[model samples]
Target: MSNIQKIGNPARQSNNLLFKRRSILKTLSLAALLPVGLGAYPSGIVIAADGVPLPENVMTPDAALKRLLDGNKRYVSGKISVRDFNVNRAILAKGQNPYACILSCADSRVAPELCFDESRGDLFVTRLAGNYASLDILASLEYGTAVLKAPLIMVLGHTDCGAIKAGMKADKENVDFPGHIQTITSELKSAVKEGVKLPGNATDNVAKENVRLNVAKLKESTPILRQLVADKKLMVVGGLYHLDTGKVELLT
Candidate 1:
């Protein structure tokens, strides 16, 4: 899908839409049977296909992070709470009021919605080959917070990222990349330079550093973002997605 589709997406406007709604009693029974706490939805709240509700219950940054982690645990344990996207599509057709914005890599293996176990319309996501933040990406995130009032932003990186390796190899061999691919390579070189100074694998460490670098940039960003952070109205953090375990570890 295109980046626009990955973002809040076009309005889901269909008056005739309707689908199966899980009985509240049945949902309560299911919740009681599960050992782990399923992420919260407001009482009598309908969970549409986008597993998570559009207007998330997270008020604080910590709560938002906890909600995501809770979802990841369910994903890791193969106990994903039932989501009715068909119903979600109908409910979200009018407008979306998502709570958190995610800056994640374009790796096929790393899906923010699935990893966070959030349903559609719950997250505002911007993606590229590397999880680096460029001016355009930063501008979009600013809009997400400034206009949409999203309270949290997460820069999510991952293990064995191809973009990191490509940059590492390019830096080591002084290979010149063709076309616009050079843009991502150049952005990542600084992280590779810093990563090489660390104590672990080259690409792996650089990938983590990339998340930190971007998170720092967002935290210190000017105009909208900086003011929001200063007023404690918004938070920008970093995370590393563990592909094998399907868990996201907080980095900053």
Candidate 2:
């Protein structure tokens, strides 16, 4: 091909790019004219930030919990929902309206979003080794509930959690872990003591106890979380994620 053909190809490409830009701008302008929550989003839903609408499925606390459990079932069955991250990227940039808040363990093997089969903007997650309700974690959860309007909070622990195991070991050996690792063991000491008294596997029992404690704490947390729970506007629950089967068994 001659240099002229190459130069002509560049010009056509430039024109096509300009045309795409014009189409995108036109689409955005039309979106502005449409009523809020009309085209892609449903009506009666409010946005925490401009162009970011809250989820429709989380109208009530029970609904939110059901949605979450359903997601977990899908995860366990290997039928997890397909996600289009690109589609949600622009909207999520403005803000998020996660339907639930998850206080989950920071263990590398356990991921809240994956276990729940949820994508970005679907869950507000805070993590610690023991999944305890630290003051900072509580504050973050409160923001998700009171401000972001998340309907549910879950204290999620996992089987064979390193933190709980370490706590149990510390109790048995009467030895301290190095560095800030001792902090996590200390936080879980009470649960470990209670677990030893309970039947069944001691490690799992301890993990469940830790989740229960945190669930209760979040329910009774003054002002925001407690009020929300009392009003039936929020539900706090506990769950233990099975490492082997990918099943999240809801703790009573």
Report the number of the highest-TM-score candidate.
Answer: 2
Worst 10 residues of 1 by lDDT: 11-20
- Residue 151 lDDT, candidate 1, scale 0-100: 84
Q: For residues 1-252, what per-residue lDDT tens digits would candidate 2 score against the true structure?
A: 533344454322322332344433553454344442422332443445433454563468888888889999999999998887888686666567789999999999889999889888889999988898865686688778766668899999999999999999999999899987887887788899899899899999999999998888788744556777998989999999999998999995
Per-candidate local distance difference test:
0.75, 0.78
* lDDT string, candidate 1, 154-217, tens digits: 9999999999998998899998789878778888877999987899777779999999988987
Model 2 error, position 104 (Å): 0.5
Listed in order, each prediction's TM-score against the native is 0.77, 0.79
What's model 2's lDDT at 103? 93
Q: Give the top-scoring candidate (lDDT).
A: 2
